[model samples]
Target: MSNPPVCRRCGEPVVASAEQYEVFERMHYVCFHYEFEHQGDPDVECPAGGCPAAGITLPSLLFRTEGLDLAQAGNTVVPAILALEKLGFAVEHHDDGFAATARGSRFVAEDPVALLGLIKLVETRRPWRATDAEIDDALGRYDL
Candidate 1:
């Protein structure tokens, strides 16, 4: 028998028909939905000219010199913590608020273009996950 397709995002076997697999880009429906369709914090829109979330970065949210408490983090920041955590960029510290991990700090310091590429991909391709080549291509296409 042929091997079942694996989801590109979560690395799980996809239980879908050939056409469904093609439609979902080999990801589970739920995984595809979350990565490509979930518009977090419906009430909050990114004020930045073209950002998907409010104009906040992992560094700005987690590595602030002054640090942040829950009230200071506010609605926009709180909603994004889980998504950033999923991306391995931040961790929540219960009532202490969120902090960036080593990997996340490196991402902020070393790869300024990564976030722009991610936003461009979500805006155009809606992939559950992107390969490096795909990110580069998206950035080029969008001139970001």
Candidate 2:
């Protein structure tokens, strides 16, 4: 069998249910939120027709979206961004879209029956969490 798909950013094989985000047709997730917020060109300043974003980089604007104190985090932010690209997800990060997968789409698409089953599966897994059993057990019950 072929190896599983890995995140373009993290270089790790996609874990089932770990969440994958899509961007430019690449499979990623950990940094999806931040990337989506900063999709605009970082070098372009916002037009000054009363636009509040007048001179900020797209990445900086993301910090304001959460009302977090950017000044405290600003200088240290670039390294974190690099690390997420190089190591893991950054603080305040988000994702743009779900990575494409045949089985995953089946769970997310608006099919009421499947959705309900998914909910039940998740509910069932919660109890298992307390018991130290495998979450995959719930999937086995579903014959998935």
Candidate 3:
């Protein structure tokens, strides 16, 4: 009818694309919007429309949840978000790291545990995840 839909992740319009999203769990086009719409994964930053990429590649999510100290979390958020973006996630670039829409957050909140969860999940895929330890430890690097 009026174009299938534009993918919010990437920055282009699309048609007939399978929108696969995984937040707390796997879901489809309709299920995703109605059910896990507002729920954002800790680190994952996938957009609502779609991954924006030709198709979804990374099929997982990893996150730390809300327990994270906002002030402390804010420090590691930027570099962490940047790392996720380099890995092909749709990051919204925030004052912290990235808020994540619905899709992107999925990958950041996958499984596994340790180091508040953020560094743990990402370490599974990207080595940069562990290196983030230095960043986290350097919280006093700047003033709140």
Candidate achieving the largest TM-score: 1
Report the C-alpha lDDT of model 3 over 28-80, residue by residue, as the tens digit: 44444545463454234455544322122344332223244444334664565
Candidate models: Cα lDDT each? 0.53, 0.41, 0.43
Off by over 4 Å in 2: 17-24, 38-144
lDDT of 2 by residue, 23-58 (tens): 423444433423443335434443333233433454
Native-referenced Cα lDDT, model 3: 0.43
Q: Which model scores highest in lDDT?
A: 1
Candidate 1: worst 10 consecutive residues by lDDT? 106-115
Q: How much is the lDDT of residue 105 in candidate 3?
A: 45
Indicate the residue-level lDDT of 2 in model 3: 52
Residue 80, candidate 2: Cα error in Å is 37
Q: What are the TM-scores, per candidate, against the unseen true structure?
A: 0.27, 0.21, 0.21
